[model samples]
Target chain A: MKSIITEPMIPKPFRIHRKLKETHDTYTIELESTNGADGFPFSAGQFNMLYIFGVGEVPISISSDPSMPKMLKHTARSVGTVTKALLNLRRGDILGVRGPFGSHWPVEEAVGNDVVIVAGGIGLAPMRPVLYSFISHRDKYGKIILLYGARTPEDLLYKKELELWRGRFDLEVKVIVDSASGNWRGNVGVVTTLIPRIQFDPLHTVAMICGPEVMMRYTLKELQNCGIKNENIFVSMERNMKCGICLCGHCQFGPKFVCKDGPVFCYDHIKELFGKREI
Target chain B: MNIAILECDHLQILLDVLRKRGYQVIGPTLGEGAIVYSDLNSTANLPIGWTDEQDGGTYRLKKRNDKALFGYTVGPHSWKKYLLPSELRLWKIKRNGVSFQIVTENEATRKFAFVGVRSCDIHAISVQDKVFMNGQYIDQHYTSQRKDTFIVAVNCGKAGGTCFCVSMNTGPKATFGFDLAMTEIIEGKNHYFLVETGTELGAEIFREIPHKQANEKEKCAADDILRKTAEQMGRSMDTSNIKDLFYRNHEHPRWNNVAERCLTCANCTMVCPTCFCTTVEDVTDLMSEHAERWRKLDSCFTMDFSYIHGGSVRASTKSRYRHWITHKLATWIDQFGTSGCVGCGRCITWCPVAIDITEEVHAIRESETVIGKQKTIVKEDIHANTGTLSGRTSFFKRP
Candidate 1:
């Protein structure tokens, strides 16, 4: 119950509204501001610096709808130290938040063309807001295709939402698992295998991909093979980020600060560095 | 806007005037056998008649035959230790029952009067200004310290062995960004400082100290000193096509060559005036009631600089060196619209194994085994022996 400070580095506290178990390793938590503030307004691909009370901070993308700003939802797998500490939090726990930072998904660029979204593993979380935007403005685009892949069936995030997206008539969702068992009745191949099955205008397609750097690297070739120009391909890149601004110098991928110049960059802009080893 | 000559006899009046104006006077003084920037309430604290010899992996202090206050090139420290600071407590977290409140550091600040800032370091400060002040988000701490600082920039009378300010187009002469720019002239019988006022406050302070209007003789003496310093440059690099040279040659053999000698000790970043990367440390009390967010200066050479879930992206020394050099020389232009290096040569002189950036660039430029252009990389001395682009305007100005 104190006056809020507006220094960019400081974090604003958000109370945990709810937490849902997405998978054995991944969980999606909903947060609401405890400090009598309005909704968090941010673009689809923007991320936030979530701070635990005594632990460190982690950069997680907002996975909820931009329209629903009061409730901020983040889907995270317990991968590192900060994420591991975040997974143990319960309801009513206060979390420090900064941003909705970085560049958003190129939803505007994809309008009036066929939109293809490719996600690998937990990469789908960053693109969830893009999906919300696309579904609302579904009439503005031609074909909408979502191609997602994971380690196995159990590792897939947002299974219920994936099913809902698949049931929509205007949208086409295709998922592939590297390998699966126990009545897993779906395609068992890499996500690139699904690129040939979808039907979209190659010249007019605007593809947005998010995933592991290796997966996105391979997807770039697959998309290019399908006659998608490098200019029309947009990929969300992930690097270790701190400060959520350009100051930390941690998230630099070549000339671009992944936190500032982009978390999302057009393929033409970063094509030179995309496949370069150890870059 | 007026220039004056302060006789060496009345130099203490300048420090006294600054102290009376409620400004902490920080200038070079002999500390641990090296000229260090520290508090000076009296003129006796100044490093009089002292000069330093610096080269790759070596430094030593020597005494000058004549008396001159600003006789040395830059040392291992910069004003950044005061501006952004080495360790800064950003905010304090206090746990109060179920709810805790955050308290940001908002204390009142005292003004600073930096007495002996060099031209290359002046450019270093300005480069940092572009990164911290002119960016999308302004750093409040850096801005607060920088805005009120009274800079007394000095034109270097001589160049260090590793100095390349002339090649970087940053110095030999202080161009802009200081409140006052001075030059030392230790002629046979007369020892005086030719000081030029660069701002209103600088003129006012110069007026308080005892000085006479600088005539053409004093002006020529100052200019001639800077002219000789420019000619005596120990190193130069071809910055004409530096961006392309670094951006295109990521896999150059010179990087692997430098990695073999580099210890990854991070001495270069520690001494670099323009390196502003920072990391935060969270310390909590035993009872877990109080936590403080402390930000410390970090270097790209550290293994944790690129740490992610599994490991670091730049795990090897080769990649870290590649990131440091490329970011400073090339990528900084893309991110900040300007190059990050000031050519002060701290990275060269402080490097334990003496890995020189100018030499590395020269080596990479010497053997043109570049990416993409798998076309023959003709080895040419195109950029060799160059800094001869005289009579041209300075390419790197303080943004």
Candidate 2:
């Protein structure tokens, strides 16, 4: 038992400044680091391992854009025990933040091309940064098309931002639901329906999609059918990310680490992983 | 490099010398119903005349004709039992009311000199090194245990029934990762160890020991014996295109076929030296004020390992087995830059069912085309490209 001492892993404290309920089960938490006034930096589509005092830790994506560095926002749905505990936290509660891990949307790569943003349910969280990046640099791209779908009208997230984007002529926003009530006046079909409505030159277009595996897979097929090359389409995948770094074997999808290699990957890079189940 | 010959009579004296030099010499000793690694003070404590006959789920010690100290290839246990301990306390947390402060225990400090390390064990250590140390998140516990350890590697004089180190390109002769390597050459009245120094410390040890320089005849004998052991390997895996095979055959029925027999007892993981999956647990006292955080080794074979919202992602045994096998043989190349398995054969020997990895690969290869037929039926209506969300989107909305 040789004692080879190295650097100690210290947990940094972050205070929950605000909480917003986007939907019934989903909530957005805005946190500020207690250690330094300078908040933790994170790109959209990257996640942080949030640790609760009594409960354990879980990986949650940073939903806010990189421009807002002072406050970190994580839009998470209450899925498991750890997330349930996280949603119970009121304003001014303390939590541990580990990383702003994984690759972000290639906004720089899609600078001069038609950018098509597709999101389903809570999947919109990871794409929020890329959306903001596009808005700030609106003149950089050609056509900006956003196709977002939720389970229901009530399940739709970022309604305020969606409303704001609807007023912009540079952006085209189409919102759909899987199932709708009698009072629902929006599109009443799958997200794939909206893909045909957006007109863009496929060869000069770069699409970024984030959603349920089923939804993303279908959307990817639609994008390909519409002439979007595999390399031009980027997708963010989900996995059980224990360690945000590449060590823990949980987030492994084939050779790629969803936490490190991607939460964002070219469709060509992970086309094989999408072929298999529980990769 | 130097070679030294130590007689069987002077073995205890050599052990004592090593012990006096501040080395916690650990070797085979009788412990817990089998020969296991333990602190040894003398040569008499070694399993001198003991050899093991090992197979799937069966291991028994048998008496050998020669009184050889290092005759056995390997047992169920490897050096990893100590280096990457089965159970470890990662961190402790104490709560005073609502506020909790985590107190980490200082890691143990002591220099260890493992005496009878086999080549496969060295490979196992290297495999674990890639997982624990070479990554962005270094495992402090494994790093601490491995840093100051000295190794005395022993070349295999005999091959076990479950041995396949040769096929994995790991064994028969100690290649690297050891301070010193020894080959025991005992013919008739001649009983001595031909020791070779691999490191400066090993050269220092060689300087202390009395021995004659090895001639060409002795070197040839050592080489011949190692070659013989390599040829005598009990199993061999066709590693060529193994990653590709697993990647391409995702729908292979062999997974489901093997899953029926696999009990998911996790014995394979327990014996595997490189399996480093862990789950964190939080324990609270009756008072509820005191809590402790423990990190325990976990296996993908368990249903709870893939637990997400509502249920487990891999609820069936077939999926779990597929995850482990693919991750080890195929996806590991992408993650760790090498295969996860070192071909130690401990997983094969320890598994309750004789689920040999070599056989499983062959089974998948042979049934690939037939498996494709089953795939068509198994394919959900969800477009192959999109996955399984075909007509279900409309049902997601509630009244």
Candidate 3:
């Protein structure tokens, strides 16, 4: 029983310090470990298995800057039962948190190279940390570009942050929506359509993409068409995950366990399995 | 390092030795309509004189002229039933006033001494060891059960209609992954079991049983039994570069042909020893004060196995069938460093429609269309030619 007590599946209690409504269906919650322990430092693109007391658990990416490990944050959509419960959580509410699991974006590897971050819908949440890391050390990388897309204007996450990032002269930000509504006056097309607007040195560019599988495929094709080698591209994948530590077999995508082997993978490593319709 | 011959009737002594040591002996028993693995208190429970005739989608127990203690190759149920149990309680959550408290399930306590494990099944257990123990996160429940298990492997004296361990290079003789290995030999009116110890635990138990040193003649009989079993294999698969075969043939039309026959019943996955996919089920009491999470066996053939946020990645029967066979034969090596299938042929026998994996792989291997398609795949992999594919890449300005 003592061995079971210390099992990896047993999540530690965390208090929701603050909860910000990101959109109609999504919320960004800041968490502080209840035990006051030195929290595990996580890298950009890693995820946490957030558990609602009596509901269920789901893998949500750490949307906050990785450098500030003490202030843990996650952005989740109210799509499933567990996530809906998470979105309803009030400040000081106790919840279970496990992980900071899976592979992270190669921010260190792209230090001297031009970094292109592409995301779609809520997919931008996982890419938020990468943008933070790049901007924090803006002098280390070359051209820093972010191309984001969503279904509509209302569906966009971190709208204020996008405006703040757009104000920065050092960063190149392009935002697009599939079906624009109201008095929206911006790029009204897929994210790939904005790729040509940003100038990057193809041979020295490192592209990191996270989105729907179809969007990821098109982004990879666009990146490769710009003379970006497959080895220089990375994509984050998603599957139904139970144990974030790779014990449960639900998150397998071919040979890779999305929870462990990647939420982030080099394009060449998974290119064969990528765009595979039946896989 | 001792070989001994125990008389047929003295098989009870072997069970008695294990029972005295507080090990609940589990072995094959004739149950309902077929031979299944279950607990055995005495030799009476053993499938004595009962030899199973097995084929794709067929199984029958027939009484043999000689009363052989271990004549069957393997039953539908495997040693995985004890190690990787179908239903396992992960944890229980109790309402602690306003907050919830988690209650972890205790580790397995029963010590198991498996009586009639086969070579292929032993390999299957080892394969699962790689999954449950060797992984980054250890399954404490599985480790506890596996650590307490004492294996008594039985060398196959005959092969079933679907048996293909010889092709997989796994069986017919119990070579490894066993505490004790035995070969049952019955000649004329005399019958005895030649036993050999594989571990110190097996040697300790063998010393307590009534047995004598086996001579050269008796050793020859044991070797002859295994030799005949190997030669009489019912099926053979060419495993040369099998990983590449499935990797290249994912789009082969043979999958569609097999999908027409596959019922998607998941019977094959349920019986397969190495298929370790599982899903978590959460249950709550009516009062909602107590809730528990149970891990249950899940099959790749299920419609929701590969489900994400939207829907299942593998929705069609063709994709499901291809995923199962290809994962077992190809991608498994990349994941676990070995083939997932031990070639027990249980999947072939237990399948309702008798869709043989060997036959499916053969059709893919023999397809002329796949050979032609491979050339196109090679060409498509060249980045320059596929630059304009789908017209989406053209949006990126060439620099």
Per-model TM against the reference: 0.94, 0.90, 0.94
Q: Is candidate 1 or candidate 2 better by DockQ?
A: 1
Candidate 3 ranges with C-alpha deviation above 4 Å: A1-6, B368-399
Among these predicted structures, which one has the highest DockQ? Answer: 1
Candidate 1 segments exceeding 4 Å error:
A1-6, B369-399
Evaluate model 1: give its lDDT: 0.87
Report lDDT per candidate: 0.87, 0.80, 0.87
The residue-by-residue lDDT of candidate 1 on A1-279, one tens digit each, is 222224878888888889999889899999999965689999999999998877879999999999889999999999887888899989988889999888888888888999999999999998899999999998999999999999999999999999999999999999999999969999898999899899999999999999988899899999999999999999898788779877878898998889987899999999888878767
* Model 3 chain A weakest lDDT span, ten residues long: A1-10
lDDT (tens digit, per residue) of candidate 2 on A1-279: 223224223345688889999999999999987765785677767888888875878888888878888889999999888999999998988777777777888898998999999999998888888899899999999999999999999999999999999889889999999998999999989999999988999999999999888888899999999999999999988777666666556766778878778989998888877856765
| Ten contiguous residues minimizing lDDT sum, candidate 1 chain B | B372-381
Predicted candidate 2 versus true structure: per-residue lDDT over B233-309, tens digit per residue: 88888788889999888886667688878899888887787787877676777775655667677888887777755
